[model samples]
Target: MSYGWLDDDTTISTDLKTTKETPFYEPIVNNFETGGYNPSVSYHYNPDVTQYHYGVRHPMKPFRLMLTDHLVIAYKLYEQMDIYKPRRATKEELLEFHSDDYVKFLETVTPENATKLAQTLKKFNIGDDCPVFDGMYDYCQIYAGASLDASRKLISGMSDIAINWSGGLHHAKKHEPSGFCYVNDIVLSILDLLRVHPRVLYIDIDLHHGDGVQEAFYLTDRVMTVSFHKYNGEFFPGTGNHDETGLSKGKHFTLNVPLQDGIDDESYTRLFKSIMEPVIANFKPTAIVQQCGADSLGCDRLGCFNLNIKAHGECVKFIKSFGIPMLVVGGGGYTPRNVSRLWCYETGIMTNMKLNHKLPDELPFRNFFQPDYSLHPNLGDRLDNKNTKKYLENLKNQLLENLRYMKGAPSVAMQEIPPDLQNLTTDEEQAIIDKLNSESSYDEYLENERYWINEKDQARKHELVE
Candidate 1:
């Protein structure tokens, strides 16, 4: 069997007999019929993260996580990946990136005492965007913990890719919260990766800028953050701009692709590949952390981009082909229904399972997907594509020019691989060990790197030969 580049339909063929190695390329052509999937993808989720309510009027809903999980189960996508209910993040773990004062405040603050602590709330930027709700502290721990566990799995060589749909709260700062995010789980997870990997790459596809994450690693070349978001004007937490690269040692490291409104799938993907291909080559990061925010999809309540579910997922498919250890997390999505659909679809993408378009009858909240009970619904054209070809060409040139400044992928002096933290393994540790022994090692998998060296040569060449 042989696999080629992604086409319009996003189909690719691969040798079915190849050992289950990286979670990226090997495709189970008919997983639904065979009940098989790549076992290297570990899914870290806790049901408790879905139980918390952010407030009645607030757009950020934890219930969407529940919906996404239900959809994954209903589609039998869980059969493809190892699932674990990760532990809540300890205060010590949170302190790795968050300040002691802020960590203590998140632990102690509650709605009952919020009125009296108005001044404290103001200081932390937790007014309307980041409100004090019941179980808010516990909720933050659960999500942050899932992300930490996901990153740990990648670092320990236990999983090729780990995902936490409840994480990716990228708007939270070191000492304050912003844009409905209370904890910067992405930042915390990246810090964890830096312990083992010399360099880490962060790519954010949220409709809003990943300001909190960009700011956290702006001064260090150890982590390179690339955020593609709707920029300019009065966008909330507006910071991502083409000119706002990085500072000091990290001058050319942080790359921001500031897009205009109503960018469609073709244009969005073109720019994504154009910029990402070179960035990945030049940075040569060992691990990657991608924030797959569903708010960027078309018809989202707050998002202005005109991307469909398939288009949004194309980014994940392209990235996975690189065969890098990755941690995927959730971010700013207002339409809970679409958010659930987008994430569930992406989960299938990660596990290399081709999902059925029709929603399963047994899926919970089935009625919520009314009118058309399909995974990829027609969100219709709500906004015109403001991004012209000329504008995109020029923007691509500017970003590529900046890459020329970098001498090459920064080299790190060889050091001893850090010992794994002294944490007890979960109940399924033995089963995981058995699976790891049966699969290919990390070095062997990287040796078989299936990369598209040139975007122009392999753009839409799709075929799954068998």
Candidate 2:
């Protein structure tokens, strides 16, 4: 293999002697454990993600996810969690939020025809930003499936914390794709959560705004959207202003923490906690979906924030502390290496494993680190902190003041312990159901046979009656 710039970054260890392969990670207590004190976690991953690539120098890399998984394996984080392959999201599931025409276009678009269908490309904004590549639809479905799987885990009480690092495509709208995000997986996951959770809170810490998700549930009181992003001039998809609260019934349900460049650990953490504490207390969300986009880190090529790995991770640590069923995902991380590191570290955090800071000797991306070999890289204060303390404090106050519209927790009708499926015992209800079922039999074959046969087909019935 050619030693590229990535190889040059690694500081060769003179001492070939190896440290312990496994870090100080605490393995989860499984059913076979001594006391059977198992932690609830369901991890969704698909290796198929790495095979696809967004064009050259597109800033969004699919291999980052594979590298993140490699680090997670090197750190033995999988041992502490239940790992499962994400089932592919069906077309019906994709139709949950996407329009029929939009889905049709994505389902059929290809790199070959991307230029031929110029109107369709313009219609969905699928040029350079959201390009048509090999396995584009399958890639979206894989990540979306992973996210939906995580959501199902939360909804069924199967997991307290679910991780789908392939997800967090936050910029795709119901009908349009934008910002390197072709499908809004976050919205699909939240839609699933709303079926079980009365109130779901979405927290996005990506560098750019989560405009797609925000607008998806903008008018619903059942889900509250909170996004912290760099809302300065010339930013892409710029819509997450502080005053863009929810409309009508969802008034004050949307919260946007718009910050300037160079937001560090201290200021960001302080601001995050200050806003999140009140949100949790008042909103009382039964579940949460947090997009941990690592592009906000200081060393990221596309982001302006001065946040380091630990600082970016503190947001996940804080969100996980609430102990609510959370669907954690990745979004908008340009620096693929740092993104991998950030996500691997956060996965360790979610598994409740106090891992050693030492990088494993057999790390797949060992050569990716720069002169410094430690997991904690020195990415300190590359830019000035434009988010002043006073301004941030005022923003917090504005949020608190605006929240007065919501007196208490959001509401949804409680589901019965065992839903009254037979409540329609009345003759009219039975007649309607029976009539519908009988009428539907014309479209469907009705019989307790090995395979279905058309009951309405007289010729087929005569042929079948041997």
Highest-lDDT candidate: 1
- Candidate models: Cα lDDT each: 0.86, 0.83
> What ranges in model 2 sit over 4 Å off?
1-18, 21-39, 415-466
In Å, residue 38's CA in model 2 sits off its true spot by 7.7
Clash pairs detected, candidate 1: 13-464
RMSD to truth, every model: 14.1, 11.5
How displaced is residue 413 in candidate 1, in Å?
A: 2.3
Task: Put down candidate 2 lDDT per residue, 350-375, tens digits, no spaces.
Answer: 87665555566678768886566556
lDDT of 1 by residue, 184-282 (tens): 999989988888899999999999999999999999888999999998856887688889889999898888888888999999998998889889999
TM-score of 1: 0.83
Candidate 1 — worst ten consecutive residues by lDDT sum? Answer: 17-26
